[model samples]
Target chain A: MSRASNHQALLAFLDTIRRPDVAAIDLGEHENLVDSGLIDSLAVLQIVLFLETEFGISFAATGVDPGRLYTVSSILDLIDEFG
Target chain B: MFVNLDVGVLHEPLSGRRWEPARLRLEVERRAAHYRQQQLAPGDRVFIGYGNCLEFFADLLSVWQLGATAVPVDARLTPFEIETLVRVARPRLFLHQGELEPSLAPIFEACNVSPLDTDAVPQSEAQVPVSSFTLDDDALILFTSGTTGDPKGVVHTHRSLRARWIALQQALGLESYRRTLCLLPTHFGHGLICNCLYPWLSGQELFILPPFSPQVIMRLGALIDEHEITFMSSVPSVWRLALKTARAPQKGSLKRIACGSAPLTAHLWEQIQAWGGTSEVLNTYGITETGSWVAGTTGGPFEAEDGLIGEPWGAVVAIMKSDDTAIPPGYGEPCATGETGFVWLNTPALMKGYLNRDDLTARAVSQGWFMTGDLGYLDAQGRLHLRGRTREEINKGGMKVYPADIDAVVERFAATRDMCCFGFDDPLYGQNVGVALVLEDTSADTLRELHAWMKHHLAAHQLPVKWYLLDAIPRTSRGKINRDSVAEACAAHEPVDLANMLGAGR
Candidate 1:
């Protein structure tokens, strides 16, 4: 899939996982999900699970930087590097 | 070391504040002097507005020195929730180290409660207030749940607290806890009494930090290595993050570790053991009423098993078929060797009772055996193994939030016709709050208004993350909410998309 399609897929997954008051499409690409109250601090784990299962990004033996999953832009960067 | 009144040096790991025994005593005395200037008398209640710092401990000690009861509140509580608690707590003064919530200004005035700054100490050499508090004097009041309304503050006297400290010393020695780190909040018994106090008051160094700050949990390995921490305790939810994101501590300085305030699965238990480089990870079982840390894996060597809590510490654990508090704790058929039943604990560390709540105290305590709402069994080896909880409280990342509390607030909303709150399992928090509401209208405007009302009344953690709009809240023929059934129904349907309905899309 192209980068646009991948981004759309990421947004859809985030919609299923974020806090009830914020929409994935409304959130900025560079916005911090947790700091902006769009998602819970622990909810970042869901993002990790998503990246690992959907994009085949493995963080088992050596953990990925949590900052990579803090924002949509950073998470997309991580996906490009790993996926 | 357990009997001594002298406490160890206090350290703020983040701020780099250290107070030696002598300096700590002076600070406590200075704060006590300051409190006396404010006419803080014996038996009066003082609310602590901030926690997890050096000043908090000093203020608590000073409050005790003046024979006043110290009530520590979760700083995240909404002003409405705080007002409800303050109405019940009836504190004479509110001591804070941070900016008081501006919204609470009116409530404080109406309640006749003064907010005092912890740093506003007397300049001149004010005489230190004499420590006149008796053993029977109330020492601490931890508001466990019911913040939205019916506040249930667990009140512990100095005697009961000392009983817990002495019991911990006898059961789990103080060597491993020589340099302890507390990443949990100080408002609750598990964190204040067992994790932080049990050792620090026994003359062991304590390194305190903001509870569960991601920055700290992210670099937990380096934090431990830098402080040479020997012991620490946290919930499985926190370990979940550290095990995935943070590097494991390489130093062999850690002697013991504990996971409590929530269930510890064998999977997470092993991961915690590996991450901390310690095999002594204990799955501790405790409740707010029992001064916390009543039982745990303390006795002998054992493999990590799911729901396996080894033995009682400073308490007698009993499993009985009858849960009736009116009957004597022993006046029932004991559960056969491995049969799960109501867990009862007879311990000297039990709280005096809920603050100003004799009815609640009566229901929980009978003949010195406090009924733990947990369903656990005593194995053939006489170890305590937990099964589940019977209470209608949601354990969100180890912070217990009651369903009734949320329901109380939602039911009061003008648009809400009926409401029921329940716990749903989550990958992050072991369980998160979810609600089923029967509103007058299903319009987006009504939901938005209800959302604003909920945000004003409820704490951030107490807000329902998953919402379900229903025609009616399911009830049994007896006219009572069966939360389990309602939650199961919610699971069969997708939760309402508040963001999409409210047009938050670009």
Candidate 2:
């Protein structure tokens, strides 16, 4: 998958679960969903689960830094690298 | 009676500078009048919170005097959760004595409601008038354990609450205990009764800690020494941290260190006793249903055994088979004669019912007994030994598994520091065990080593199927693990591609 496709995938995945009315959830903009409260500690775990099943990928202890999962763009970059 | 809260009772007041019983009556009456002026009324639910210890206590009786229910809430809940609770309870008034206004302002806005703006400062001299309210009048609505979800409101009448208070007073001979420090939040049953009401009823002084801290506990020892302190009540976690970081209370000043809320392990209990100086570290058991602690040790302070929750105090306890029928005489849950089973509290303090949840209320209480979902067998002697929660038990390939049992063993591993063991959905077993752990060291190979270490102590089905190592586990403001969020974390699946479906953000 291309970089744009991976980014699109991440946005689509977030949309599936995120409440429709959440503001400032622009996947392309912010990199840290947690610090911004767009997503919380709970959301971070959901993102991990999403990455594993969608791409048939797994996260090892050292495979990815959690900071990489902060925003859709950073996550897309990570997914593209793995893909 | 002059109440000294810094230390447990130095002397049971045989006779001292006494406030005449008539004078105490006048004090209550005075508070009642103040609440009436504030327009508080019967059936109105008031959420009592703030950093000021005095305001939290005085406003309680004041609200009650004005015929309102004082619903104490932990100020620690996330704004979202707090907003949800406020909506559910629809408290007529919110009395907060701290700088939470900026945070609560947006929540109140979202709900399309305006909070009553009060002076940002707190008054120490606020007093209320005395009024005679029926024992059956709803006095408080404490929340249930949040292990499942945002805690539900458990309504309690004044009579029921008083019954619990009196029972605790009688059981512990609380007249003798003064000079208290409270680490528990004032919102829940245990914290409210033990720290707030108990001190008030005994006319003792209570210094409320803003939050639990190891540094604060160290200072507590010094304060006890400085003030000649006596009694303290804390949860197991607070005591554990104190043992690790601080010296015990001064030898002669402190009397008892009480631990409750979660199961107290034997090793942890002994460590607390050793470190708490001569003061006995007492294990206590109570719930919102019981109003306050119902069963505990009566001996000096420490239990003869580590994990045993003493005997049932003026409460009837039983162990039943899976069918809810009492286990036959020969084969009962292994509690001491008075101990075991779900640890039912037959006190008058059982909640009137869950607020707006008749179905849940019916399910929780039956046959004049509240069903505590805890699993334990009474010993032949009647002492209760809690194995942990029956509801929290995990099922693997038809084998029943207790997460606490496994967690206790796994936590003993040198590599593991703090852990939360729970079950997630699995196609094979319906629900398989999984664990999210914070390691003593965050190493690349830590997860691999943990998986191996768990292998020796746990069975195949009992072992954690998936391991997620965290820098820190998510905990509620009170520092208990947020199981619902953790379970949600476990159920979360990896993201699926979206390009084929909807377009990007509009």
Candidate 3:
């Protein structure tokens, strides 16, 4: 559970679902969160339903690569290769 | 006139080869002899901006086999919406395929650029001449997904796109052994004229997909049984995210399933009829000034109703009155037979206007119908229904409401997964109700139990006096709902105690 606390618990769940005057920056764990608009395409389906309900994990049973769920160090290497 | 179909690329994440229909008509006649070696005349225009490959359908069939026009755009627009569409489509060729948004380099150096590359695919053997340009010329421009404003363009012609591919081959009987499965975005008209030019002019078999990710629509039941895919069309948010992560397709390899640009929630049309074990799900209706799908729903099993849509086909629909007139056909005019108003239409596959806006083509056409800023009704068994968008209705103090009846009571809230319901600037109701949402639990006790189930199924000027939550519900790259950015994120949020959560739900 520690990649700096999974990047501070994924930037505190993307600053509690972003856009309320955005602000919470520091994203670079290999940046690109959806080509830099910092998350979209429905926040990549709310980060795959927040890693299947906050880390029970299962991006279709870990065969991950939906383009490495678009960055923050490839979603912390897909939650350390599928949580 | 020559597109005898058989194109099959299936998974082109930037050229992973695989095309055939005689190498996609010899790469569309060597890109129509490089648009007749750049003299590009026969009614010019061009633009394209490619993306979902096969070299964006061979530069849109070599700019409609050189009778020219083909505008296309939307490679996720914005370099100020491609410099307001190259300052309103003054294109004599912009033909892009990659890299040209360094703020559109002086609008691609004032037009005439061309590089739509797949390694320039033209190994000669050129027979280029065929377009003496008739079918009254113009041939396709498309745009309008400017979610309730600005993006205009529209146009069409080549005899209103062969009367919308002969009204979708006489209302969806489209043959040539069907195949289909294209996955939207061919710069809209429901993915370039109903999923890729009416299945490439009804000589069918196209597979395409790539670029539409809910992990590529939860891998549509293994790409519809490895492309045996018999017919599909999208947008009901990609069949409600492929009925929540795909997987149900093995009964007779899915014979049909449509669901047009928006309206279709009868619980996602009965979960896309039990996940395409087929009742041929249809439920369409049209726009982009009437060309794409001029009304649908038929092919049996039915029950979803809320602007049900069902009957127009070659088109005529009416109901009018927001001053463009019509509403008089029978049972007492206030929009007779079943009541709602403003839908219109009249189609021979409409549109040949709006490009240079003649004041929005005289307020969206009049003497020959086409008003369609939507809001609908027809019924007493004539079928039409739709009831939202005449600028997203919701008047509050004068009472009008319809945000698809508060998105069918906030999509029956099992923690709501998407929703919009707009109309915001209310100085005591000149326009009020707001809404936003997109939750499966934005937890604050799941938004105070969805504001106590939308104050027990709405009606206090149809509730929602602003409430945003939103982790998504922005849309419009033709999945619609960008209701002016969900009424500017429900008028920049800040109304969340919801009167102590509707007085603690009574």
Candidate 4:
């Protein structure tokens, strides 16, 4: 999938998981999800599950740095590299 | 007797730097001198906001060495929250490691703000004499999670801290040569007293990990192998995640593992024993008010009721009615054996009081016993079994419903990953039951099947009037699910039909 489509899919999943009224969160490509209070340690686990199921990619099989999954840009980069 | 404790840190992101304990101690002392040079006198309160790092430990020791109080805030807390706490604490010095948010700068304007760098060599010309403090001098202040209500600062004196360490030593027989692996945040009593202070006082080494995620804790096996970690303690939620993600034990170095902060289920306890490769898995019980852990199950798995918290450790446990009347100390008293009521504890390790909240302190402590606000009972064998929190208990009309009983029953469902049951305000019954579930399968058929199974297991008044399917059950930093928050969240949603969920309750 293209970068735009990937961003759209990611945003949709995040919006679903985050607080209900937080649907209009403005996304900078390189913004940190945790620092912005959009997610937390537990939410990261849910995101990993969402990535695996939605993108058909397994993070366990291909080891990824947990820190790299903390930002929007890095997560998209991970999808490009592994997907 | 002066005890020189050895401290070490496993820096996050795996910096392959070797840490010498003796060198670290000297560095900490130097930092203490630096703080003293900055006019931080004895009995002053110092607020620290650094995460789990060597600098956090150094700053803590520095404050204690000066006979000052250390108030450690959770690094994950918002700047507003931190500012609020700092205002309440009214600390003289605000020592932080990283950059403070712009919002919090105004809050620290009155206090002296100092940037703490662990790697910075301590430079001081004058010889700073260590302040002599009595055992009753206040040492540390930890804020509660504020799950049910507003967070209050729980204060502990040097004497109370030492007493807590002694109680744990008597109960667990902790000693040197046993390295401990700590993943919990040091700000909380469980992490500070039980994991760090107890081990360090016993002259054992600590392998401190950064804030835990399931991904980070999955690497526990490797750390245990490298550090030869023998003793470990964490809340029940982390253990549940570890059982799912972590690799099994590689060696028999793990000796004693304890789970506290929340009740441990029998299934999870058995899994931890099998995967941990240790026979001495203990289910502990305590709160911040009573120091760290006051009671723990040793020798084997809890063979009694699901919430059995085992015997007391160097403390006295008693059961009292709602009206503050103590149950007579006998086998067959009306409120003594096999009857649920408020759990009361009297111990030397109890907190001095809630900071600046004299009314709450007076209400919490009466005579000599600290009211735990926990609903529980003593069995015929005198072992304690926790029901639930007094505030979280569902009063359906006149009959009372305990959430722990429902949680125990619902956790048996294979599809239920995690569950929380709480009480919501209802005009009809005064209070009604609500259940929030983090399920493995969210399909309609699976939920239908689970609900059907739940109906068969729970009684009419005990059945949850509303059900919420959640991605994850919201928990505090210490892994405790705030039942009040869950109930409020359920109340926010469109009300569910109780008759439809639990057909025609009497």
Local distance difference test, each candidate: 0.86, 0.60, 0.67, 0.70
- Writing each residue's lDDT as its tens digit, candidate 2 over B85-122 gives 77777777776654555777776666544344233423
Query: In angstroms, how far off is B17's CA in candidate 2?
Result: 22
Give interface RMSD for all predictions.
3.2, 13.2, 12.3, 11.4
List clashing residue pairs in candidate 3.
Answer: B307-B385, B307-B386
Model 1 TM-score?
0.94
Q: Candidate 1 at residue B418, lDDT?
A: 90
Q: Report the C-alpha lDDT of model 1 over B63-132, residue by residue, as the tens digit.
A: 8888899999998888999999999998989988757888888988999898898887765644656677
Question: TM-score order of candidates, best first?
Answer: 1, 4, 2, 3
Off by over 4 Å in 4: A1-15, A18-41, A47-83, B1-13, B111-128, B145-151, B175-177, B299-305, B323-334, B391-506
Which segments of candidate 2 are over 4 A away from where they belong?
A1-83, B1-35, B98-132, B145-151, B299-303, B323-340, B393-506
Docking class of 3: incorrect
User: Weakest 10 consecutive residues, lDDT, candidate 3 chain B?
Assistant: B325-334
Model 3 vs truth, CA RMSD: 23.3
For residues B1-506, could you state the per-residue lDDT of candidate 3 as single tens digits? 54334554433522446676677777778778877787787787887876466777877777777778888876655454565566667677777754555767766676545434445546864675576577777888876633112446789887887787787788767653277767666777777787777776565666666545567676677668766687777766555455544566664687777767665668768777777777777778767677778888763555787558778888878785564433322322447777888777777878888777778777777665667778888887787888886555554432345576567768778988888777776432346677888787775667766766765555344667568776787777888776777777666666554434433433
lDDT of 3 by residue, A1-83 (tens): 78889888887887554432234466777876766655455456567667767777754322344567677788877788767
State which candidate has the highest DockQ.
Answer: 1
lDDT of prediction 2? 0.60
